[model samples]
Target chain A: MQAFDHHTPQTLPEALALLAQHDGTARVIAGGTDLMLYMKSGKAEPETIVNIKKLQPLQGISATNAGDLRLGALVTLRELTRSPLVLESYPSVAHAAGFMASEQIRSFATVGGNLCNASPSADLAPPLIARSASAHIVSADGEREIPLEDFFRGPGESALHAGELLQAINIPPPKGNAVYIKHAPRAFMDIAVVGVAARLELAAGRCRTASILLGAVAPTPLRARQAEAALAGQSLTDDIIANAARIASEECAPIDDIRGSAWYRRRMVGVLTRRALTALSNAQPLHAR
Target chain B: MAKILVSLSVNGDPHELYLDTRRTLLDVLRDELGLLGTHRGCDAGDCGACTVHVDGLPMTSCLLLAADYHGAQITTVEGVLDDGKPNSLQQALVEKGGIQCGFCTPGFVMNGLALLSEKPRPTEAETRAWLSGNLCRCTGYVKIVDAVMTAARQSP
Candidate 1:
């Protein structure tokens, strides 16, 4: 690892100031799980590290006045998996959190870092997007909220400015059932080949709204808008679900990687999408192994 | 980078030392504190060979900067010993023949001890899920799971 100045800021303003003073050369580290890997590999060599672990505002999990699930930036993946509120309200999010790397890594890996890192295969991205979540970003200038779907610009890139800090992620109260399926060779400590999340709002045995999101098959978590449109206001029959799955598989832009080939990922996306829809249609239990 | 003075409690011992900013907690434990029981496998977080209890939760020490955990309570593999003797988990591992190369033992012990402390009698599936982070290439992990199960049963 490269040598750098470490700054433990007690306040978010102080942390933002350090980032601004460094002029985009400083990095904010909470868990340092992903940042440490990047630093060790020389992929990231920040001149200053703004440690935000001490900032109180970036901690805890709560519900907004409007019943939205508000997860602070520093809330670790372990906390997400254990929070009863999260498990009850957003089982898909909890499942995705627990389905990540490993027990040790999840013990310290934060939700903010997970989204800010902007990995296409990030477990939290697809579920949050499917739930219509938004990100709250703060800086010395002030704070602003943006749709979570717009947060990811590319791989390892986010909408955050140089000095901006991700405050929290807010998801509206559950209006539908959401399921996230990660297609990976190993159940634990492995990245996904193709991940799919389906959120459906059904009324009178017909779908009123559908949100379909795919991961690791694009530069960012891609929402299959066309597939979602196909499911809208339609009966979720086996044939209809299969048609929507075919449409989703055709729309994502996957690449050949060591984990899997693009062809395999595309095929798995179809299979996983069909499974997710089938599970949701049957009103099966949220827990999926 | 310049060295910074950091204070942390390791194995119930408090100490302050001047360390470079790049030195990880694993380096501080193995090189600075001379606690060699915490092995360093993958410098990355993939391998849990450098696992330790940071404030009672198992974390990969190699990825943690010592400076970042100034006032943290750290429990290494050595810290779990009862009066300089192997604890129930260690004894169970030995009796169950869970050791082969022994490189991944300290990590497995640290991780398993934390799990056992939380859930004294975790099921086989729970044990497998909790220890998934620590990889033991040898013994095929059968004896390890058995050892944890035995320790859970023997724990008071």
Candidate 2:
């Protein structure tokens, strides 16, 4: 990496102050998996690195009083996968976390860093978006929250300002069965070609609500609103699921990349979306299963 | 630039040094501390050649800034040895013919030792998945997986 002043701040306020003092020339280092590589390649050459790893407030995984999952910004992917609350209540999140880079990378790669890096193929984005998660951002001035879907502006771009930091991700209580499927050549250590996440709330054998999100095929993890509309209030039959999947495939604007061709990603999106919905439809009721 | 003071315990030894903040833990281990067991393969964290246990969990040390790991417990492949002797996993790897080029051995040892510590009894598929990050370019994965399984079976 390039030569830079590394600041390990013990408190979030101290970290925020350091960031503010540096103006726009500093970058916050979370896991540093991507940042270090970028710095080495000169893709990102910040004058200062604010290490927030020691901030205690951004390091917990707990359920709020209302039963929503509150995941701190610094929670590693391994911790997310192993959290009882995540594995039980948000299996899709755990599944996504489990499918990321590898055991070594997962040990330190933070969910916050993954989102802030804003990789189009980030595994956690689709699942968290499907669960209607929100980003809790903290700044020296104050704090603000926004829907996770709005957090990404493009590949490697986020809604965060120069001085703001993502503090935590708040996931509301799940109301249905969910699944996150990542299509990669290898089961591990490979980025996704086409990632899909689906959550369906069923009542009286009809779909009461549907949330479908796609990754790797768009500038950001995209909510397939058209496909979701097709599933809402409709019985998730083979034909409806297939139609929704087809619509989802068309909704994304994928680019031909090394992992896969745009055509291949589009085709895989339909297949994976159908697979996710079919599996969710066949699964037992949320509480029972 | 002024060097930052970093204090940490590595391989059961405590060290305090003033080092350039740009140096990674992998660089510090290999160059400053003379811990050559932790090899540097892809420095970009793609190859787990520099895998080490930071605070009891396997992590890619190549990406960790040495200055950020103050007061942390770091365990490299050398640290996993059983009183200067090969641990069960190391012994099993040798017996199972898991060594070809031997360049990836330290990473495999660190990662395998972690797996054995977490799950003493792991299935073949589990073993394969756990060692997925540490790539043996020789593609001698079957014996590596076998060695990890053998070590688990031989334990207790």
Candidate 3:
């Protein structure tokens, strides 16, 4: 790895000031899982690295009085999965957290780093978007909140400005049960070929609202508006699910990569979408493997 | 880049060393501290051969900067011994024919101890999921699974 100056800040203000001074030439590290890889591979060469692990504000997972779940930026994936509040209240979040990486990686991979990495196949974004999670970002100037949906600008790009620190992600309690499924050759440690998350609000045995998102099938994790629209105000029967899944598969634009072919991904998106809906209707936790 | 002063405890021993900012915990351990039990295989995080415990949490030492973990407690494979002897997990692997290329043994033993410490008797599914990252190219992982299962049964 190329050499760089490293600083550990014990407060958010100190971190912000250091980042501001270095500006575009510095990188802030929460968990070094991904950043270390980039550095070792010579893909990233920031003159300075500000380690925020010492900052107290960025190291917790809690629930607010308003029934919102707050996950600090430094909360590792293992912490998320092991939290009783998350496991009981947000099964989708727990499943996605556990599904994305191996136990070792989870111990070191942070939620904020995962979001800030901005991979198209991000396991948390679709579920967080489905749950209406928002990111809390802080800079020397002040703090702001951006809906998780708008947080991503493109692959490896985020809306965060220079010197901005991601404090925590706040999630409104979900309306109903949820499911997140990833299609991959291995159950763990592999990137998603087609990741799908479904959050449904049901009343009177009919769908009141549905949020469907597809990952790794587009440049950005996207909401399948056509499929969401199809499932709205309709009973999820076999016919309805098939139509919705078909629309979802058709909606995404996938690429041909070593992981899979575009045609296979497109087809699997439909299959996984249909399966997710089927599981939701059956009230079963979905697992592809 | 200039050298940075880093302090960390390894195997109940504390040491402060001045190392280049680029020196990873793995390199610092093997070269600076001379704890050679932690293998350096696949410097990338792909292989868990360099697995070590940072505050009781297993991490790929090669991926971690020693400076980032200043004042932290780290336990490499060598530190996992009990009373200067291999622990129950290591004993099981030996009795169950789990060793072939011995190169990955340190990592496997470290990861096994980690899993058993968290859950004395992890279900087969749980064991498989937790240990999936530490790949052993030889043995096809059958004897490893058996060894870990045996250790779980023998553990208190």
Model 3 gets an lDDT of 0.88
Most accurate candidate by lDDT: 1
lDDT by residue for model 3 over A21-81, one digit each (tens)?
9887889887788899999888998788898999999888898999899999999999988
How does residue A172 of candidate 3 score in lDDT? 96
- Scanning candidate 2 chain B in windows of ten residues, the lowest lDDT window is B75-84
List of clashing residue pairs for candidate 2: none
Alpha-carbon runs more than 4 Å astray in model 2? A284-289
- Per-candidate TM equals 0.99, 0.98, 0.98
Question: Candidates 2 and 3: which is better by lDDT?
Answer: 2
lDDT of model 1 at residue A17?
Answer: 82
Calculate each model's fnat, 2 decimals.
Answer: 0.75, 0.78, 0.66
Poorest lDDT segment (10 consecutive residues) of candidate 2 chain A: A280-289
- TM-score of candidate 2's chain B against its reference? 0.97
Model 2 agreement with the true structure over B110-156: per-residue lDDT tens digits: 99999999999998988888899998988569999999999999999
- What interface RMSD does every candidate have? 1.0, 1.1, 1.1
Better of 1 and 3 by TM-score: 1
User: For all the predictions, what are the DockQ values?
Assistant: 0.81, 0.80, 0.76
**TM-score-based ranking:** 1, 3, 2
| Candidate with the greatest DockQ versus the true structure | 1
Q: What is the lDDT of residue B71 in candidate 3?
A: 97
